[model samples]
Target: MRLRHLLSASTVMLGVIVNTTAFAAAPDVVRIGVAQQGTGDPPVFGGSPAATAQLQHRVEDSLKTDGTKVEWIFFKGAGPAVNEALANKQIDFAYQGDLPSVLGRANGLKTHLLLASNVRAGVYLAVPPDSDIKGVKDLRGKRVGIFRGTNLQLVADNVLKEHGLSERDLRVINLDSAASQAALASKGVDAVFLDYNLFKLQRQGLAKIVYASRDGGLQFTRQAHLLVLEDFERAHPEIVQKVVTSVVQASQWSSDEANRDALFALWSKSGVPAQSWQAEYANQQLKDRSSPLIDPFLIARYQAVADDALRLNLIRQPVSVNGWFEPKYLDEALRTLKLQSYWPRFDASGKPIAC
Candidate 1:
């Protein structure tokens, strides 16, 4: 009887050890996908280890304490590739522009918005530096380079409509941002509708900004959003909270004058010239407000985007913006991390004010 009791105790101890080990190893590393642009033009994600390191550090700091790890995957192609990876379950989260996210939602992919970035940042209509084109109206019969199913196209369409022009008014060539920059430099297209950052190359005298979407307070509403696979969020709430916390912290860090300089330095190493960085940095600071918080206005804007996307046939059907976003995750993360009180508050005019 004594021997049997000893044996039973040993078995119970072994079972406890096994259960602890399994519990500790249950959660897998989170995979994040980022778009990688080529070495030329605006330099989205190519060079600079310091910048990448900073980003990695921010992510680790957010998720590491809970035994979660993050693995980043870079895709060399455009938004379509990123969306494909998300669809294939290869990545848990990504930063995508407005149009691609809309397209992704339309294709039966489950996605949710984490936060909004740079909604008011403008798009530029550019031409070769020496070209005589003076305004949007001048490109009526010219070939225009644009990335279909991206924010650039949305801005182009809205701007053209404002000018009493339509898609039929110009020759539209579907091209990615880098390719569009090359096409513009080589004069393959008379003009290109591109993001504000891409204008960095044009500022180098490689091209010229013929028109900016911000000219008329037009509210072009070009935006980038943090997206998470719905299923991933369902399975890993803690990991998702960590990601939201980190992104909020990064945005706050980027807001500081000192850290802004560091970020610019990182961007500069990525092929963005100093002057261009200064200009784009200022513009981004204004648009992003560097708080990484969402507001009612942002939600309304997202709803508007979904409506416009459906009307343009960029999306098959309208997605209810309310169903796709849950600010609770962000709010909880901020509160838990002591970030809520420190974040900048923006007024109705989109200007930052003391909270």
Candidate 2:
């Protein structure tokens, strides 16, 4: 069974591998960009476009003519690459991380935060297994690896702040995820801001997790959004609605308890290994984390993120967080699909806002 394939015990502890929308006169091909999906050779359960891609086919087939095509773009450069694509009006929808999407808006790429793809993603700090850095503060003056301009940077900075430290207090070395992992292996950096993949390094005894935001607070965790270009949305509301409908449908399937094993297996194609998903999702409810609702909680958090980014000089001009959301599409999708109560809504601090 596909579900059984996803839950194979040997796959659990091992290490491996590893949006948008809008409309014009319905372009010949609809380009969907996955900012964090670098080439997506090995599917990652975290935020892969696999589920949505399948859902997209159905939506497109029913909503458009046979000539219409769906084109997916995966960028290894992550958010920045997608941001560039969106800016050039090459991408209609973008499933992207919080920080880059925020910066994109601040830089004048018009997009509506349609539905949230994911929330409460964890950030990890990995240090050499033999290092004396017992906690965040211990590395104040030491070298720290951060993939600058990515959401991980903010998560890392926020974690540091929680420990009464700041990026200013440390020698911040900018490195991409792979390079940072390698740096940690070579002891090139005292610590590297990373994610669930930290487990692989731990298995290798190359690094150890010093801090993580896996506990109950949403603000402490990284967030991702599903966004659509404003121009496209303005041009074809019908297509945008269909896209939102499909996303909601996919979200519904994803939230179902019975599909857990199959869903994880689908994500295992990213070379992350099925077991890695099991470990990462241990004790966590899939629905609680993947709600597609564009609730106030995300809006408030983005406002706070924008405020902090302004203070931190991550963006030139202030990003209008409130304007980022155009919830009508999601609202309609939920209502039409009878899924209004399917996904719980939360406040910006991540508390369930009674539906």
Candidate 3:
């Protein structure tokens, strides 16, 4: 479990037969899938300057001299759509949120958790101004907009349970984030569970904040993680290692205190307000949540997520969280970059566990 041990494993070494560093079986094109809303000018989600492009450049520089390229696959249906691509073997790597990632694995999609990009991201619950809805308790018997097949469905349901309510108690309407936001603003739905977009609408006096997981603590936050297809891992560990290194490097940069303002600005390029980003990350240290380390906290949290999915029938079977992680690449990357001690580590409760 130590960085030194993981990095020194023989499997972590680069493998290439010719002057060309391309794998004997490396695919001509590497496809990285984005499981978020879109990849437009101001994307809803993607790894543009984050890690995907950096991975492409690094691979071409050190391994693929024959113009091996990285292609990004964008999705509108979010995690469910990305799971389709992963199941069909159309993608080599993917970035996804909790529910679909775990469900895919439970249903036999072969992939490994590579890294965690962000955590403690609060889900926004917005009700129309002058509406009688006050909180989760008020959501019962009300029409609430939820994106069913995505993680939001389960996340919102869990939040409701925390208030002694359940999805069964409400009239749930399925809609994507964009449509959901519009519907809420138009009073088409009694309430909506979404992300920072809700807060932005709240600022405009179009919606009222009913409940925010921001006050619910780290255990309530939804997480996004990077994953690699298992077949690709067995065939091209070298490529996987390099790609993970790029993400680790990005995480390192994102966790620096000096980069806090710049990171928020870059994130705001996705069309979210700069002030919203500031509020969401308020009082949070950069490395506390952004650290790429696959620690005990992260592993245990994902385990509980899988368990919850089973209990709620979101997933048919249980997934083994521990075996699903391929941390050698991340460990190796940290050591080579001399960043083993650069980021803070925390336990399940978000308490500082290491540095």
All candidates: TM-score: 0.83, 0.86, 0.87
TM-score of 1: 0.83
Candidate 3 TM-score, true structure as reference: 0.87
Superposing every Cα of model 3 onto the true structure, what RMSD results? 7.9
How far out, in Å, is residue 205 in model 2?
Answer: 2.8
Local accuracy of candidate 1 as per-residue lDDT tens digits, 245-316:
777666655656666666666556556565665765454443254445676556665666778778777777
Comparison by lDDT, 2 against 3, better one = 3
Listing every candidate in turn, what is its Cα RMSD in Å to the true structure after a full C-alpha superposition?
4.9, 14.9, 7.9
Top-TM-score structure, candidate number: 3
User: Which lDDT values do the candidates have, in the order given?
Assistant: 0.70, 0.76, 0.76
Residue-wise C-alpha lDDT for candidate 3, range 1-355, written one tens digit per residue:
6877876664455332342455455667877787766535434442223433333244445445544677767777889999999999989998877788988988899899988877656687889999998788888899999887676677787788898988889999988888998999999999999877776888899999878876876667777788999889887887788778877777777778897777767666566766777767778777766778887778877887888898898877777786898888988988999988887677877677854
The best candidate by lDDT is 3
Q: How many backbone clashes does candidate 1 have?
A: 0
Backbone clash tally for model 3? 0
lDDT of 2: 0.76
